[model samples]
Target chain A: MSNKAKHWEKTKGQMIITMILWFFFGYVIFMFGENINSASFLGYPLAYYMCAQGSIIAFVVILFWSAGRQEKIDEEFGFTEKEDD
Target chain B: MFKGKFIDNLPKIYGTYTGGFLVFIILMAIAESAGMTKETIGILFVAFTVCIYAFIGWLSRTVQVDAYYVAGRQVPTVFNGMATAADWMSGASFVAMAGGIYFGGYTYMAFLVGWTGGYILVSSLLAPYLRKFGCYTVPDFIGTRYGGNFARFCAVCVLTLASFTYVTAQINATGTIAARALQIPFELGVWVGLISILLCSMLGGMRAVTWTQVAQYIVLIIAYLIPIFWISNKGGYGLFPHLMLGEEVARLGELEAQFGLVKNSAAAVKEAGVPGGLKSISLPHSEVPAGGMAAWKFISLALCMMVGTASLPHILMRYFTTPSVKAARKSVCWSLFFIALLYTSAPMLATLSKLSLMDPTLPTGIIGKEISAVMAIDWVSAWTAQKQAFIADFNGDGILQLNEWFMRGDVVVLSTPEIAGLPYVISGLVAAGGMAAAMSTADGLILAIANALSHDIYFKIIDPKADVRKRLIVARSLLVVIGAFGAYIASMRITGILGAVAWAFDFAMSGLFFPLVLGVWWKRATRQGAIAGMITGLGSGTAYLIYVYPKFMGNPAWLGIDHLRFGIIGASVCLIVMVVVSLMTPAPDSATQKMIDEVRIPSGKTILGKQH
Candidate 1:
């Protein structure tokens, strides 16, 4: 495959991982939140903290990690944007 | 000392801006004690902040298309993130999300999840490619990618519909906040807020909107945080509230048990608002589906909002303003960081605010108090006079039931400072912050639609050769017309801000999500397929919304998907349709296929656009 194909594959593979994480935190945890609420964390229901606070914190980490990793991939494939306009 | 570029100056400028704003707030607090009326302080807070935005707008005004449309494609990553955060957080997020949590409980967390999660999709699948595509507007991408005016026109239609719905909600919020502060009629407040937004954005287009939004973000974050920190300290949560919010939630849960306050039940009549005139009379956090439907509702709304975030024109437009595609991707991280500062605190704010109100130890506590005495309390009487809180002696027992003392969700944050017995200046400050949130979002939404109308519909389709001056003039004129139309709808009190925001997301998600995503990722997507996809997704989604809505058909939702989540059905149908049609139809030309391949790469000139 061409470099273009490789770049696209690397990006798509990263995205698939992202979507899985997004699904797990965004839906799976919340879907079973009732059961999760049976457990407590830091004096609050576990599911509630996950949804209201922990999940948002996770989203930030996910985006930043993906961005750093993608930048590395861009460097590997020489796809980084030129500095000068 | 600072001879560098704008990016180099941002921290210093923003630091000074923050310090100066703090000094001004302190001055106003002093003035408040010096017999400056509450109304005067409120007016000063709004007028002063708006003037600052207007100054920034004036400084940034331009006739160049790139500057007007994409801020000369030079916004730094961090500032773009700040601006995007401001633009994304409308009146709904500032004034209503905590209120939504106060009312909706766990299910309401969907807004936090969906709104933030959508950025994941933006970073991974959309923003980078769209930036590389190098279009001025979202419809520009559609028009060029699909190779026709028809596809662009359809995209424009969806963009306007979605954005217009959202703009109305912002206007509603602006009007309410303004009306209370300025002692003006609600109808008049709509125009006051609308005019401030216009003054901020009408002069400079995206350039002005971007800078002014950055400034607004500072004011809003400052405004949002002060009350939280104050209440946190007073409530014994100390300076770092998040560490102790779970304990507070446990306290609130205990209070709920003590008061028999179950979450998500249909509110009593008085609290629910007027009798069927606008469902808002008691617009709880959302149509949180009950029982087995709860999980589906959360997932569905979260999915709808996430897709909608990835697809919104105003949001996507922010990415185009960044200097590079990498900047576009990185900005999402910053955007989430800035936004998360507020979102993470929201549930805590909701918990702490609710705790203060329901603690039964406070003088304002009313759940079990006699209705007559609760009605006589200063804050209660004040809010009652404003009709924001209604205390009814429903049972003739003359006591306030948990359900009897009805409060508008919009009032939660607005009333928190008062409930906490802080200085009225904090209320004025919060008002300014809420206005900043509403105005910033309105500026972006109105500009998004106007850009679509003028850039896509007028220049692209009507007269491709219109001059720069002519194009800018046309865009500004359209902004006035659209702003006025949005204000008129808002004045009618159509629905609650949060509900309309949900509708806007659903509309955007239904019509634009699949087509835009496919245009970037799928080489086989044809013009015909794109057009078919937009129409079907939008059409089916809107039909379901109206069908499931109580005011309309009142039909039962399929698979527990409420009207608010109609985007799910629409997007699914659209994805299947677009793929099928692409396979059946003749393939797009080789150039188009190559363009698709090029969009995925990040290091070159935009295929469909000109570099400055």
Candidate 2:
């Protein structure tokens, strides 16, 4: 396979994984949160805590990680721009 | 220090600007302490802020097409991130999202989740690729990728429709802020909003809007964070509300249970008293639906919001202002961080505000001396006098039932300071921040619509050889016309702020999401498929919204999905249509395939055929 095609496939894989993680963090947690309302974290219902603040923290972390990972992939494939000093 | 003078001087310039703002705030505080009428203080605060934004707009004025179109492609990643956040967090976000949370409870998490999650798509799927394409507007991408004016025209139509809807909501938000702050009619407030937005955007285009948005971001974040911190500390949660919010949630939960009991009993008694009386009002947070169809509704709404955020034209336009593809990617992360700062704090603010409102010491429904006492509690009295909130004895038992207390969702953030008994100046600051949010978003939306009209419709289709000067004039003139139309729609107040914003997102996602995503990823996506997809998706979505859902399918939604989730259906139809049609049609030519390859690469140096 061409190097470009291989890189594309890898990027797609990474993206799918990231998206699945997001779906779990965002959707699954919210959808099933009520099931865990009895569970307490930091003095609140676990589900309610997720809705209030946990999911947001998860979102920020996911983005930062995804961004960092994407930058690494770009560098590996020589897709990033070179900085001039 | 020896390289570029502009880069060297950046911090100094920003420092001076920050210092000047602080001085101005101090002077304003002094004037307020000198006993200026609150109305006059509000007017001055708004006027001063708007003038500063206008001055920034004037400073960045440019006749060059490059600068006018994309801010000369020179904005640093961090500043662009700030600007993008300011542009993304509209009045709905700044003023209404928390209020929605306060009123709608867990169900409204659809907004918080959807909006923040959408940034992941932008960073991972859209921004870097679009930056690689190096386009001026979203239509430029469609026009170039599909290789025709027909595709361009369709994209322009979608852009205009989506942006017009979004801009009207923002103007409505601005009008709401102005009307409340200035004690004027909403119609007049909208007119004031239009003039200020036009002044900032009509002169310098994206260049001006970008700088002004960065400044606005500072004002808004400070405005948003201050009251939350104050209230959080007052609630004994300390300064870090996010860390301590769980306790607040627990307390709120207990209060809710107590109120729920009172509410149920009140409803039962009221039903026995008056057989046909309206339903007793429950605590605002008590209506969050749970399990089964409600969960499906939440999922669908969240999905629609996610895609809609990714697809909105004005938002996508913000990425084009960044200097490079790498910068674009970095900026998305920053935008999410900045936006999350406000999004997470909103729930804390809502909880704090709820606690204050439900204080047991406050006089409830008594008519004589107790009513006077309640009226004397600044926040309660202020909102009551304005008819934004009220307390009444519906059951006439002479005691205040928790269910009898009602507050408008939109005023929670605005009345936070008054509720906490913070000085009146902070109230003014929040108003200015709300105005900043509304104005910043409005400017971006207006520019998007005008750019589509002037660049896609006028320059590309009408006069291909139009000079730079003529193009700039057209863009400016279109801004004025669109601004006036937006103001008129806002004055009509057709829908609530969040409702209008939701429709804008749904429409954008329904029509543009599939096409834009496919354009970047699927090389075989034909022009015919794109055009068909755009038309079918938008047409069907609008049809369902206007006719089918409202007229034919009433009561329970089809498959537990309501009209608000129409984007899901529209997007599904679009993806199917595009893929099926593309498979049947001949593939795009080799050159078009090559252009797609370049778009996939992250480097900015990859040139496609020719510059526009």
TM-score: which candidate is best? 1
* DockQ scores for all predicted structures: 0.64, 0.55
Indicate the TM-score of model 1.
Answer: 0.96
Model 2 alpha-carbon drift over 4 Å, by segment = B1-4, B261-289, B361-372, B376-378, B548-556, B604-611
lDDT of 1 by residue, B1-612 (tens): 567887679889888889999999999999999999988999899889988999998988888888898898889999999999999999999999888888777778888899999999999989988888888899999999999999999999999999999999998888988888788999999999899889988889999999999999999999999999998887667678887776667766666667665332346453545233111212222123346577877788888899999989999999999988999999989999999999988887777777777767766566777777777778888877777777555566876655556677777888898888889999999999999999999999999999999999999899988898899999999999999999999999988787789999999988999899889888899998999999999999999998999989999878988878889988888888888988999999999988888888889888865732
> For model 2, how does the per-residue alpha-carbon lDDT over B1-612 read when each residue is reduced to its tens digit?
234665456556666776777677678778888997888878777888888999988988998888898887778887888899999999988888777787667777677888888888887789888878878889888888887999999888888888898999999988888887777898999998888898888789999999899889888998899889987776577678777766667666666676563454655545544222222335344234667777777777878888998998888889987777888888888898898889988888877777666656433222222444665766667666776876666567555556665567777788778767776777888899999999999999999999988999899899999998999999999999999999998888677677668888888987899889999888899999999899898888877776535555555556865677778777888888889988889999999998888787776474532246
Docking class of 2: medium
TM-score of chain B of 2: 0.93
Candidate 2: count of backbone clashes, pairs at least 3 residues apart or interchain: 0
Query: What's the TM-score of every candidate structure?
Result: 0.96, 0.93
